[model samples]
Target: SQTIHQWPATLVQPVGSPLSLECTVEGTSNPNLYWYRQAAGRGLQLLFYSVGIGQISSEVPQNLSASRPQDRQFILSSKKLLLSDSGFYLCAWTENYEQYFGPGTRLTVT
Candidate 1:
């Protein structure tokens, strides 16, 4: 009965501005959370993953960071955005090694 939720659905921002995307999972305990990005014609790229509270693993080096503030909450943030940061952001939770994604957030940096 675990459900994942992501916010804003879509965003358009100027370069050098701040960015914050949130993800939360309900009806689960000690779940694994992940953040991914997808660009046009590109496969889903793993950005970050959390195995436990405050334990985050970065898969790619970029101008972004991830944090697990609560057991069921994960956040992706950028201090300053870049044009190259535009993409579809996805949040997912893992259960038994299978990841279920949220609706996703589309971000456009201009």
Candidate 2:
């Protein structure tokens, strides 16, 4: 069975602060990892994706960045958070077109 974990279910930060959110998967190997952000009343927008270590594809150019340093670990970071960056952050893995999502992290930037 494959499962994903994300930490700090919710977050509150001031603008221009650094951000770091982590996601990890268990019971799978070399799975496609993806980061998505959902704004209020909007569909999810892809932030980044990775097929393997050090391989990442950015779907949007924003204050967010992603990295995959291990087979099951993925990280999302921002050097300076922005007010527009406030939203629900989700980490997901895909087995073909079927995707499983983590609980998600809600961020509020003021």
Candidate 3:
């Protein structure tokens, strides 16, 4: 029974400001974690992924970065956000090849 959680369900920040979004998993250990961004009515784009603690891989080139400080904690951070960064950010985990997603965070860059 694993559950993923993401905070700050909605965010509004100005361009060039810093951003931090957190995601954590409960009842699961060493699960493959992933970060994705989805534009309105569009498909999700993979951002980052972790196979284990301290091991992160980028799926695409972007202005953001990710870290896995603990076995169940994954973080997404950016020193400066851009207008194109605004979207719905999602945190997900894979179990037995099935993916489970969190409630998601909606970011609006002004």
Candidate 4:
């Protein structure tokens, strides 16, 4: 049984602050990892994805970046957060084209 974990289910950050969110998978190896952001009442937008360790592809170029340092560890980071960065951040893993999402982290920027 594969499962994904994401921390700090909700977050509040000021404008222009640093951001770091972590996600990990258990019971799976070399699974495709992805970071997606969902705006209020909108669908998810892919931020980044990784196929293997140290391999990442960015779907959007903004204040956010992603990295896969280990086969099962993925991280999303931002050096300077913006108000627009506030949203629901989700980490997911894919197997056979099906994706399983984490509980998500809601960020509120002010």
lDDT of each: 0.96, 0.96, 0.97, 0.95
> At residue 81, what lDDT does model 4 achieve?
93
Provide the lDDT at 17 for model 1.
Answer: 100
| Candidate 2 Cα outliers beyond 4 Å, as residue runs | none
- Model 3 clashing residue pairs (backbone): none
Q: For each candidate, how many residue pairs have backbone atoms clashing (under 3 Å)?
A: 0, 0, 0, 0
Instruction: Please provide, for model 1 over 31-88, each residue's C-alpha lDDT reduced to its tens digit, 9 standing for 90 to 100.
Output: 9999999997899999999999999999999999999999999999999999999999
What TM-score do all the candidates reach, one by one?
0.98, 0.98, 0.98, 0.97
| Tens-digit lDDT track of model 4 for 19-67 | 9999999999999999999999999999999999999999988999888
Model 4 C-alpha lDDT versus the unseen true structure? 0.95
Winner of 1 and 4 under lDDT: 1
Worst 10-residue stretch by lDDT in candidate 1?
Answer: 92-101
Error of 2 at 33 (Å): 0.2
